[model samples]
Target: MKKTTFILPILVIAVVAALSAVFIVDEREKALVLRFGRVVAVQEQPGLAFKVPLIDEVVTYDDRILSLEVGPLEVTPEDDRRLVVDAFARYRITDLRQFREAVGASGIPGAENRLDKIMRAQTREVLGSVSSNDILSSDRAALMLRIRNGAISEASGFGIEVIDVRLKRTDLPQANLDATFARMRAEREREAADEIARGEEAAQRVRAQADRTEVELVSEAEREAEVIRGEADAERNAIFAEAYGRDPEFFEFYRSLTAYARSMQDGNSSMVLSPDSEFFNYLKSSTGGVSTR
Candidate 1:
């Protein structure tokens, strides 16, 4: 019984020690063995790894692709236009030793923060070289590629492989949007007013033309009517003069008959005149005759 008790304790202790010395590294992880706060080995592959019991520490990092939201940043282009930029990056830890050396106790969070700085700086540099119009132009694809390349180049110092950098959104600031809208509205209003003024000018020209045409037409009609009336009076006077030359008595008698007819044209007319009045000469004589004065 005593021998069994002694062996059981020894076996239990050995089992505990063996279990602590061995660790399984998963395919999704890269592990580092640290002794007394110093890096001793890096296990980059998935398998069983061994370490000193109670004296060594193992730290694991993800080998899979990691995403980082670089967060929102602001920049001013060459034209002094302000923009709010949101970006993200895809990266993986390429050199775990270098990463651990650079960021000793800070872990992945600290490394990601550092990478964010690199991304922000490079994004600002690439976007700052051109005007804001270029950011929204067809060349924006090339511009974004340059930004990604710049971030990738700068990310190497931090022991990370930057696969790509992408902009989530690029837009004008809220203040700039309000100002731009105001300017657009003002321009539209000015254009509308100009159009109205031009329309009024055209209307005035048409009205003036109509008034002038009416005056010219009225004046021409009056001139033609006056000429026709004067010609009619001349023809009547010539016909009377020719008739008088053919016979003196006959002309006087005919004129008296016309005057008498005109004076008596109304059925209820009354006239007080002497018997020898010239108006009655035509009634007094059946023959064509006039009394001698």
Candidate 2:
């Protein structure tokens, strides 16, 4: 019983010692074993690891790529246009030892801060070389490529690998936005005025053409009417000439009777005339002979 009691304490001590030396790491993590607070070895696999009890330490770091949103930065392009640019970056610890040596285990935030500064500087450098129109147009992709490449180049010494850099948004300043809108409105108004002027010119031309057509139509109708009246008068004269040629004496007598009827219609007429006057003779003539009636 005494041996068992002594062995129990030894077992407890051994278990405690074992617990102190044991290190557990996940698949997506890497651990650095430190002796006297100095890095001695790096363990990268998922399993149990060993360390000196009470004298060694283990510091674990995430091995996967981390996302860092660097937030928004105000920038001005070459055209003197100001905008706010929001961006994000994906990075990973390529060299764990260097990462631990350069930035302590609790220094990821500092490294991120440094990376943010570098990215902002590079973004400003690249973007400052382009105009606002280019940034908003077909050169956006090229600008982003240049910025990413520049950031990768600058981040090489910081023990971090820049996997990707992306621009989230680019916003124009409020004052500039109002100016742009006003310019657009003025352009639109000018275009509209030009169109209206063109339309009025077209309408005037159409009206002139219509007036010319109306004048031509009226002149043609007047000429045709005059021709028709002249033809009718000529036809009447020809018929009268034909009738006069058929009977000369009868026509003369009929014209004398028509003149007498018109002159005698006023019953109060008094005329100085001789009995043998031709005008009285025609009136006195009756039947087929000339006689006083």
Candidate 3:
């Protein structure tokens, strides 16, 4: 019984020791084994891991890609125009040993602080070298790539891999907003005025053309009427000549009668002439002094 008690205690102690030495590393996590604050081993893969229970410490960090947001940082561009910029980054811990050494006990939080600095510096350096227009334009993708490249080089020293960097937003500073809006409004108003002026000029041109067409049409109609009137007068004169040629004496008598009728049409009209005037011939002689055939 004594021997069995001793063996039971030894087995229990061994089991306790084994349980304390073993740990699990999840697929989403990376672990570092530190002995007396010195990194002894790195477990990047998911599986079982072992460590000295009392003397060694295990620190775990997320293995997945991490995200960091930089500031609404103010930067001045080459044009001396200031802009407010917000940016974000994707990164991961590529070397666990170096990361632990670099960050020490601060872990991910410390690494992030340093990473943020690196990103901010690169952002200002790359974006500041270009004009604000370029930073705000679609060409900003190229600038972002430059920032990412710069950050990657700097971050590599601490075992952090910068996957990507992007500008979330770029805007004119609050102080510049009113000025910019005023300038935009002025430009729009100028354009509107130009459009209205052009429309007026075009309307004037159309109206002038219409007026000229009206004058031409009226002038042409008047000329045509005059031509018709002249033709009609010529035709009447020709008819009178033909009648006179047929009978000269009768035509004279008819002309005298026409003149007498016209002169006596108004009761108030009076004309003083010699009694032997030719106008009175029709009144003096019924056949105009020509004997009937």
Give per-residue CA lDDT, model 1, range 1-293, as digits (tens): 99999999999999999999999999999999999989999999999999999999999999999999977789889999899889898999999888898888897899899889988898899899989898866557777788878877777776888987778888888888899899999999999999999999999999999999999998899888889888888888888888898777778888877776787786847878999976666677775476464
Q: Please give the lDDT score at residue 65 for candidate 2.
A: 95
Root-mean-square deviation per candidate:
6.0, 7.0, 5.4
Best by TM-score: 2
TM-scores, one per candidate: 0.68, 0.74, 0.73
Locate the minimum summed-lDDT window of 10 residues in model 2. Answer: 284-293
lDDT of 1 at 125: 95
lDDT of 1 at 216: 94
The digit string of per-residue lDDT tens for model 3 on 1-293 reads 99998999999999999998999999999999989999999999899999998888899999999999998898999999999999999999999998888888898889999999998999999988999889989767899999999999999998999999989999999879889999999999999999999999999999999999999999999999999999999999999999899888888878877777788896847899999987777678765576588
- lDDT of candidate model 2 versus the reference: 0.84
Please give the ranking of all candidate structures by lDDT, highest first, separated by commas: 3, 1, 2
After superposition, candidate 2 runs with Cα above 4 Å error: 35-37, 139-142, 240-293
Quote model 1's TM-score: 0.68
Of 1 and 2, the candidate ahead on lDDT is 1
Maximum-lDDT candidate = 3
Q: Candidate 2 residues 1-293, lDDT tens each?
A: 99999999999999999999998999998889999779898898899999999999888887899988978788989988898889899988777787777777566887898889989998899889988787777447778788888888777776788988888888887787899899999999999999999999999999999999999999999999999999999998787778778776665677778877887787847778788878765556675332224
